[model samples]
Target: MASARKRKAAAQAAAQGAGGGVLAVKARYDAAGSGRRMRGWNPPTSGPNRAITGLQKIRDRARDAGRNDWSGESSTQHWTTNLIGIGIVPRLRRIKSKNRKQELNDLWDAWVSQADADGVLNFYGLQTLAVRSWLESGEVFARLRPRQIDAPLAVPLQVQLIEADFVPLLDADYWPGMPAGNTIRQGIERNKYGRRVAYWMYRDHPGDGQLSSAIDASRLLRVPADQVLHMFEPKRPGQLRGVSSLAPILARLRNVADFDDNVLERQKLANLFTVFITRTMPGGVDGDFDPLTNLPVDWGNDGLPLAGLEPGMSQELDPGQDVKFSAPPDAGTAYPDYMRTQHLGTAAGQGLPYELFSGDIKEVSDRTLRVIINEFRRFAEQRQWQIVIPMLCQPIRDAWVDAGVLSGAISVEEANDAKRVEWAPHGWQYIHPVQDVQGKKLEVDAGFRSRSSVIAERGDDPEQVDAERAADKERDEELGLFTAPIQPDPNRSDGDSSGESSPGRRPDSNKAKK
Candidate 1:
């Protein structure tokens, strides 16, 4: 049977070769074809084209949903909470001079207190706002504003945040003159090599009627690309702009809201206790009965027929009359389950765990929660390292250093050296404090991790922590307080001079007496 199958395959290949060369596979992906399953699956393949045509409407719809819908608002808040809890603080990694590094740090702290161009938020507050905006609007921009040398700032630099609306997503060929190979696509002006040269932005927000009139709204400013920081997570290879994080789940959120409203309306109608009376004969109270339809002819003060029900009150029906109550349709027993499923989908689309998104942890065990959170932390770390740090924090660091040098606060020779920095983002809280701490201790004891690394992971500077610990220890000793001995070196021999024994070693009884 195997030989016959092989012979058949060889004959088919030979026939194909004889007809032409090797024939292309005629089969195609089912999803790519035009069957009923794929009929509504068509989406635009070009990211930039979509941005140019429909980005404004998409952004507006996303903002509307975010502002009005609870789940939509919660998703953006959760992202901001996780990504920029306190701030991604920067540490100078200068090895040549410790004093210079301290000076730079001091200057940074002073400047951070006044980093906002509008003077409304501090550096960390700006971070939170920037992350929130990026999540809600799909993109955020910051212009690096330079101040004079005599300005009352440690560093003559402040960041002015620009909303995504400031930059118009319109395509244009070179503004009619100078350069040949320059064209603007989606507000970003690129040269021949496709490197961004500038961004064409409105001087004032187009939506702010007070800030921009119809006459001044058309005026645009060409800002150098290097002077602006654009923060967004790009989904495609050449996506010029970002689409909202809420984009995928907008329709679902709207549907869920509508469903909730409908359910509430049903409950409201059910509470009215409306009753219908049917009569076999048309004889009843003359003023209360309609002559034509025999329905209620008396109208309430509010202009509607109302049947009032009072406790312990009974009314006798006429000779051949019956009464029945109207029942509004109720959301069935599956309503909660259906809502849970929809909420889970929304959370997943927003790249969040259901437990975090809904604050519903009744069904999740601790172990399961740990797994969910750890997976989420990995994603958060990726965003911190890949997007937040590189795009926002690092550029701000470089600009601060340059501005410091220009203002004579930092030496020109040390400007490049001072720019060597490492960012430590706000750390996550322990899932189970005691268990997590013990696990970390074990890792440290086994030499699998460093104490400095543990400190950094807890959202602290390792060197600063060590220095503070040393100061506390010295103060304790000077006040005649008991100082616990430091842990013995695991690699030290039994006869080591420090007089502390290794783990599990028996203390010398003779030494106690001496």
Candidate 2:
């Protein structure tokens, strides 16, 4: 087969007309006894000229017939026939194999490089390429997608630092009454809330990190620890209070336009607060009264033994010396033996004063008042307590009202009385008539009453009743439910046996015979 194909190819390439055979010749014969007109040529008998003319005529006729046939045929059939005549069939070849993978890679590279050169980053293209590469290579792309590359990831450092510094200060200052043990936790909670507020403020206003931090600190200081925890627990997205509510307040404090600032500020602040609060409290105040101090303490040691005398005890024995013990113990002396002994005594005394000889209760009260005032001053300086207390207290008052602790326009006693009355059933009375009317009852005949008393008393006539019954019987017969009395068939028909016959049909002939 290979050799035959080679030979055929060579022959065709040589171009001596496809097949090796010579062309066929046309057959003709000379006729004798021709009409005599001129000497050599016979006068117009059917000669080669006539024969050529006849052949030309036949060729013209055939061409005209083909044209007519083509015109008569449908356009689709004619096109198909023309295609066949031109040997167009059996010439179609399938497309050659393509390097689709390389082509795709080249297209992708061209788009990416063009974008990179123009400084116009194509995020979608980059993402697609990364995903495609991962799918093809079974490995995640080492390079970042456009979105990942462009996205701001780290929280702002300044915001975080501000939260760290300001929140603790706020807790120390504004919440002076809060025990030291709980301070860290409270501060952390407040920090979280304040950071949210600050985020709202600085989201649009950049570069005021100091002011924003201060506002956050102030808010943190002002927010009660309990309230902060309730609002920020579970630390997931969308857990924060409505931005609409928090944003305006934060914006006013930060002196900014709106709350569309960088989210990193908020996120960093949140994370910082979370970490700060989750950690052990400093100063041994852990939201519970310390058994030793009978004062709020944190999770830290504070140099005071758990079973020792109250914290802040002095070595001086005289009552006057108690006044001299106002300051915290000097550096290394904070946990002195005398202070520890006093702390143990205080703890044993159930937080009562161990000795009246040490100092007057009035003096202690005075010292506490001073500490509170100084803390307030610190808070004010830090700008953490800028909000008026009365305004902040409004929500608590509203909460009380909502919880039904207070009534609207009524005393508590009166409201209680109203509620009781509403729950009691009303309309609990009954009565009966003392007398009844009597008369001769009019008789109804077959549910129809007569206009004349005598006619109604007489009742219906017998003849009319019989006629009505007959008419009812006829109506029932017309409705096909009853039949008039019929004479028996002489043939004693057993009725039609075929189920196709209706009740109205006459008996079948076979039945009549039976």
| Candidate with maximal TM-score | 1
Model 2 Cα lDDT, one tens digit per residue, 136-246: 111121111122222231110000001112222122323433333332332332243334221211122223344443534323333332232111111124332211111
Q: Per-candidate TM vs. native?
A: 0.85, 0.13
> What's the residue-level lDDT of 64 in candidate 1?
93
Q: Name the lDDT value of residue 495 in candidate 1.
A: 68
Error of 1 at 373 (Å): 1.0
Clash number for model 1? 0
Off by over 4 Å in 2: 1-177, 186-220, 225-229, 232-514
Estimate candidate 2's alpha-carbon lDDT, on a 0 to 1 scale. Answer: 0.29
Considering only N, C-alpha and C atoms within 3 Å, which residue pairs clash in candidate 1?
none
lDDT of 1 by residue, 248-285 (tens): 89889989999999999989979777777777754454
